[model samples]
Target: MSYVKDSDGRWHTIFDQTKGSSCGPTCMRMVVKMMQNRDLGEEQARQLVERKNGVAVLSTLTSENGGVGQMGSHNWGNHGHHASGGGGVGVGAEPLAAALKGTGIKDAHVPQIYARQALLKTSLKNPGIAAVGWGGQWNGKRAQGAHWIVVAGQLSNGNILVFDPIYGIGEIDLSPAIPKYRPANHEATLYNKNVVLTAK
Candidate 1:
């Protein structure tokens, strides 16, 4: 499978990855969609990642046992969310990579990308897709933590293109996405760290 674009050269429709805090899963969904050139809708994408990552069973059973909004004494609950409460918990690299491995997608690599240079060299250069972790200010505004977005491509002028599940499709105009983010293993506060999902 290869990345496909519309007649106008834009990526396909953007889909939300989760009803709750499932940024990793959502970004994985974005990677899958772009790599396979398919529009796997939001609900299905959310379910697939959860199913593969073992969150589905836990969420489903919890929902069944406690009607979705039932948050227990231990503060654990179902991913089948409601406006009230009781929603999903997010996963990190291990589970995200495991899910990708289970799919057996050729040329797919779920590796921890620690440096921004490497991310640009590998991911954006190929006009490829990457599930990137970024934080701090984005588009000159404050952003959230442990979040994920799919990098679609980059331009010669240093405009990094992406498809965000929450913010929709846009550009990551910032090189490294965060200049101050010192490269680290698990840090998501800066764009320096990412559990990148890359495919040809």
Candidate 2:
């Protein structure tokens, strides 16, 4: 159910995320490959986060109560696909933009807010992939935190072809609402924050 067939009858590969906090790097890695025709491995993409953020890979967490927390820096929940967390940790809008720029994607940027669905479709048709900040769950649950996923392309039926690092590849119908961060009837949600790279 996660895979979809293309026009030429090829099924898209599902690049699932290995850690709860790795969605950012995972999506970025896919974007780089789609844009430049170069494959960046998981560790390499994590290192890219370190180089861009100017911080060592986050392997340990310091709690506010002066206690050392286990696993990654922040708690993004330990889901099935997300094993023990660490390495490259997490990324925000600004840090994600910086990381993309560091990868030679000079025009990479995170828009101030969500753009129109038409514009989003247009971006998907561009020369590269887009990283969407999602806040909903596959089960249609509303989440407080955001998740990163790649919008690979638009399906012929008007559904969005999404490469969710956490949930795998699937198509979803997005709402026409402006800030499409809220879930409607328990479906995939999207935040206003997005990291898009239209150029190599």
Candidate 3:
């Protein structure tokens, strides 16, 4: 069965929380819940994303940004619990790092590509949550584009458990192999990943 922090935790989903773009923030919400049992509301999560270097507003829009490329992350450092401004402009490493800096996990490491898979696996295997960047769905394939999601844990079967905000697949099996993006298939897959945040 798919797992989520709790029924209340699901409310942190992007659609439930932001009228704008927020895959990255929504994923962070899951990270906060996985790392800590806190049920960060969408409003609170959104506020954390907008903190510091977050792109509170985007100049352009993309499908991944949910047509609202004008907002930020959610969850940790969410003492403010602010709501998203409402646009789908997704964030990159810089914004994510900035958001981390504002919280107790300021030193969060975003690994370089060469070591990404290993670090992600190690963190999840160590029973830690990993906030990851990917393509939209990540259905055991390579990433075709950019999106954000959470790596909740590793299943006993050795498959990766992915928490896709849009698909809402709880702990779905993601093979160890990294799938590449195929224009024809459009299979949402994982590409690069990192231990977005963790316990100090």
Output the number of the TM-score-best candidate: 2
Total backbone collisions for each predicted model: 0, 1, 20
* Rank by lDDT (best first): 2, 1, 3
Give all TM-scores, in the order shown: 0.57, 0.64, 0.56
Q: What is the per-residue lDDT of model 2 for residues 107-126, given as tens digits with 9 covering 90 to 100?
A: 77655545444235433434
- Please list the Cα RMSD from the true structure of every candidate, rounded to 1 decimal place: 8.4, 6.3, 8.6
> For candidate 1, what is the lDDT?
0.45
Ranked by TM-score, top first: 2, 1, 3
lDDT for each of the candidates? 0.45, 0.50, 0.43
Per-residue lDDT over 1-200 for candidate 3, one digit per residue giving the tens place of the 0 to 100 score? 13444222332322232433456667666655554556666665566666643344432222332322223332222211111222223445445555555544555555655323533443342222233323433344333234455554444645445555555544433443553322223443443443454433
Give me the runs in candidate 2 sitting further than 4 Å from their true place. 1-10, 54-89, 117-143, 175-186
Best by lDDT: 2
lDDT comparison, 1 vs 3, better candidate: 1
Show where candidate 3 strays beyond 4 Å: 1-17, 54-89, 114-119, 122-145, 170-177, 180-186, 193-200
Q: Of models 1 and 2, which has the larger TM-score?
A: 2
